[model samples]
Target: MATWGPEVVAGAAHLDRPVRWLHVAEAADVGVMLTGGEMVLTTGLLLAGDEQAQVAYVESMQRADVAAVLLGLGRAFRTTPAAMRRAAERCGVPLIVLHRPAPFSRLTEEVHARLVHGRFAALNLSDRIRSSLTTLNLSGAPLQQLLDEIAAFAGCPAVVANLAHRVLATAGDRNSLSELMRDWDRVSRQVAELVRNDPVTVGPDGWIVAALEARGQRWGQLVLFGHPGSEESGRMLGQRAAEALAMNRLLGDRDRGWEEHAAESLLSDLAAGAARPEHLLTRVRAAGLPVNRRTFVPVVVREPAGRAGDKGDRSDKAADKEGLPQLLDRILAEEAVAGLVGSIGADGTAVLLSVPHDQDADAALERVAVLTHERLAARGRRAVVGAGFGCTVLDEVRRSFVEAVHVADAALAGPAATAVARLRDVRLRGLVRLLRDEPELQAFIERELGPLLENAPLLAVLRTYLKSGRNKSLAAQVHHVSRPALYRRLESIQALLDVDLDDWEQLTSLYVALLAHEAQQAVGPEAAW
Candidate 1:
């Protein structure tokens, strides 16, 4: 007690240790009755004559991990004991001597009251955080919104990362978060492994980390980057945030992994135009995709047409295998490309690549395509990659995604020789695929190819003949027939459809009808008129 002219007799360097509580005891063996972090108060009357007992007392306090030992003068030796002081100094335990008589009861009451109040405040803050997070969870807020709330409470950056240490979501000041994410891959890997559930400061910048686990499995970590508050409060906030995230994951599609789910959610929303441009931009930025002044290229990759099967089977097999989305993520990371990749529907993987405005978008797209093909080839898998026109404006990216989907569909209808098939590569087939659902096109296909639809052999012959530029010998070779046999079949086809195969304009009409019919067939039987 400073009021009683207290003086630090030994271990003054450890005076700032946290005091969990104040204990007033006169017994030399009182250390055995106290737990750690208690500031023990005593008059030392029991150790007045026994030097060995005085040394034992200080040694016991050190063993019990007491914050400090307060020895009052006048009742014991009227001065600090040399044996006890030496023991305290040796043990490195703070030992304070009360030169004037100090009231142990009053000091204990005041310090205990403060400690209790502090604990109560901590509990209250904990409850506040829990209640707020619960409310947000109940309202079905997205993961990013929940992270934003955590960052606001922490007054610092908050990040959610998977077991692989890849950052999935982040919330904080825009500039600070951008800077932090610039080197996130390296910085995140440097974080020390968390052995305890409580938030512990780690890394060179002292990031507070908490594990996000559920059902006895830890999937990710919640990190408070550079929190500027007391460690106790930061731990409390981190724990609550981690709980919310785990709950959110559980309530979400538990079948999908967290990273995939995040990417799917963001990219799906952008593609569907379900979210505003500003909102989508905010989400992309928070998801660690570079958005500011970047060129956005929407790409879709899917299995070739002949390989596509039942939706459920494709989805299950893709889930089991190294799917396109995972492959794209790996390629992007290796190439140092900033992008968001995710599975779309059962047969296609969607990617939104972000390139710096100063970079060549075409070159970047080509690099990604080449890398994707090489990796897929290594796995004995092949996919058709379709890329849309790059856009510098964020809002136009959604249109690009739609264009990519159309290009992918068109590429599936024919043999795509290139690694990446763009709009021009798909040519007229792409346009017909995009407009295949129009009623006029459907009617036109039915009108032009109505009779051929019922004659499989004749339809095949006609298709071969038209595709071979009306060259009878080539068509005969393709159909495995002599020239005379092909001519007889062509005459039967001309008689049935009442059209001349030799007329260029009529042949052109027939070819367009064939293209539309194939596009409709690719869509399934329900699409036919």
Candidate 2:
């Protein structure tokens, strides 16, 4: 408008319309040369001096959706024609009059140059955003960081949610999460199924949504508020954000699904011992787990260890590690104590419950462990659930959890294949199991039985003597040897290990060594050295 020194006498409200391109035509059917959003800078001399022709001209430009119409005042019977002005006012199209003749070529050049510049700027901004997010994804940034990048680019709050509309990650200073969470389903339901990279605003507040998808599976959604750029640019930003999120999910472990992410965080944080009880309570509540139970018990369920041939073999462990936690969640839900369950080891899972304090929770916990074991077995999973003692104080639940894990470790390393092993049941075996990793304990086992181990005849006599509680006659009968033969073997054992067979203290020490040796054998044959 300034290039022609024009006056906008009507539809001044539409003057700021974005001009995407500039077109000039002298034909009576000038609308045929125009497209929507193009500023029609034309000298309408061909249809001048005819009111009906002027109306037809304005109506045609209106139909073409041109940004604005500029009429040369002299040839078009200037002085602001009423017919064209009324048509412009009716159609809400900006009408400008060039009082002094101005070349249309210069105006088109100026406006087109500005249009191209604006376009390049938008494209560059979008490219920079995509490159930044792609670089962040490659650098192994977490989901939250990616959301922050989107939020910063969008200049508004951003959130990541599952298809179920549960918020997984949020990035914003003043988030409308509680607001959206109130009517989340309503908003989510309004989103159309996106076949490609289509971003949509569900409502009036400019909440834009994009799908987080890969390999034809939609993992979740990425949403932003008050998206600042054009719809096309916003969509480009959204599609790239989705790709980055999918890449991040592919690169991450365990957090592949938001539910897994929630469980792992809850269990790991509580197991860390430094988490405050109130903070922990808040976390569990946020996870949609129960906190109203009377007492809390920690139980560890493990699939029987795979063949010790290669302890790390992961063939069947996937089923147990993935299935046990899911099963425990279901059982606990039925018991009305469904809460946090986590995979703690390759073949082990842990669950912490909140039960009533007054109830006999120790018995209830035992029942739960038993049911879990049976359920797992029925499912062809053969699991052993080691239950820790019940606790009234929530903070002490972590301690119980530790004890339960220790019990499970001992039970798995012991000869007994009990499905439910309490702390008390693993007593001596537990203590020895703690020392199984110690070089001193292994040395002690090797030192005491060093000489007699290879001499099977003498070793058998010594073992029987030990089993018979030092009753020489019982030892002789069990070994099928004469009293003199047993006595000779015991003497030989005592001399080899430098202990007196008559001394009760020495006998007790040797018995403890033998117990340790048995535990090591139960663990692995190589451990029995």
Candidate 3:
């Protein structure tokens, strides 16, 4: 911005592009003579009367990628040119009018000086942020201290969220942080995939998010609740924060932080009422998880199957597991659900999300689960989100969590369970799972399918036929065999088990036996009832 007034005549939105150079040119084809980012000044020497010529001049400027085009007035027909204004706006090149008969030399000098000063100031700021963060790192400051400094630089609430937008660490005033995080699931979903080292504003609130990445993989995000300054500053602040977080991540095991450990411990204890209600609230609040005050929806995410023995598959699974926490957090934030996510079991994540009371719980959970599956699929990972009960009371949360676990376990049992199942949908399988170790159930399974169990192929054929409800074509298709081949296997199964294939009552008994068998396989033989 030069001291000499250069009022914007059109395309003011583009003023955010910082002017890097200024050029005084009256030639219509001056864009060909300069590099990009130069705010070209013209007196319409060749564009005074011709509208086409003026439009062409603007087009050339656009091609050269100039920040803005200034049209000097008085000599160029007394007033600003309509052709030039429309051209600049149409081409998205800012049009600035020099209202007064100003000297070009002074304007050029002023703009150059300002640009230089701004660059140096930005450099100084980067240095300061780096210095402070480096000092903190060298002194072994906790992660929160680094985040606090970032929040200070941004001048707003700041948070660290796993890829799923689950808040990991936060800084700034508690009230303000709460306000910023409220309905964060929907808010965070508006975020775009951030380019490395580039910060982008997200949502209508102008919140800024930058990737916290290392070794070519992004683990989570650093967020400014509301960036208070120019995009340049936001980018700088985000980059600095990203650097600090990445460095800290390299220096420490972020997943094993005290905060994460504390959350896991708290959630684990909460599942079984290890503490009193009032004390639990205090602990939840201290851990930054909203509880007792909002409608909570418990969810569990787990891989669809156990890892294969292939090295490639194992590596991919490991990567997905490592990324799962971040992914869940990001989803909740994007869904605008006020949620808390933590590690649970060996390869699963758990979330306690707060949704609006009036929100459709089934739709919300389905969408959350669907989107989670979709996003994870984009990274070549298959995951399922099982939903539990939704409740307002803190005491009810434990039951909801337990239900979520049951639903997740059911989904893990087979492909038919779908990626997202509600507690109501999985109750039967859950019950069967719980009773898998009962001697009666074991005896029943043995009586029904014991003779056929010795042959794996025959057992598979029988299970598939039962799964299809004796639909010969579907079972044959599933088994990748012809109808005759499937019938031969069915006859063998019938001969071996001495069961009637056409009897619905016999089919029911066998189905129950198969369920018991699968339940044992799913939980593993060593698993206790």
lDDT of each: 0.80, 0.70, 0.74
Looking at candidate 3, what is the lDDT of residue 98?
A: 73
Give the per-residue lDDT digits (tens) of candidate 2, residues 1-529: 5655779876788987877787887777878877698877766777777899889888898899888887778776758889889989998899988898888888878777887887898789878988898898889876667878888888777877776766576666443544554455565565534223544433334557887876678767888766766666676677777777888787777434766676665665555454456444434543555455457777776666543432333766564457777778788777766457887745667787777666676666766777786776554556556767887666677667777766776666553355578877878766776577589998988877778667778766766677777789998888788999877888888788888978887787777677677667654311231
Q: Give me candidate 2's TM-score against the actual structure.
A: 0.60
State the displacement of the C-alpha of residue 92, model 2, in Å, after optimal TM-score superposition: 4.0
Candidate number of the best lDDT: 1
Models sorted by lDDT, best on top? 1, 3, 2
Worst 10 residues of 3 by lDDT: 520-529
Instruction: Please write out the lDDT profile of model 1 over residues 384-455, one tens digit for every residue.
Output: 789889999888887788788888878877646888999989888888877887999988887888898999
Candidate 1: pairs in clash: none
User: In model 3, where do residues sit more than 4 Å from their true spots?
Assistant: 1-17, 46-53, 79-86, 190-204, 254-290, 293-529
Worst 10 residues of 2 by lDDT: 520-529
Candidate 3 lDDT score relative to the true structure: 0.74
Give stretches of model 2 more than 4 Å off: 1-18, 24-27, 43-47, 71-78, 96-114, 129-152, 166-179, 182-203, 212-220, 228-230, 245-258, 265-322, 344-367, 375-529
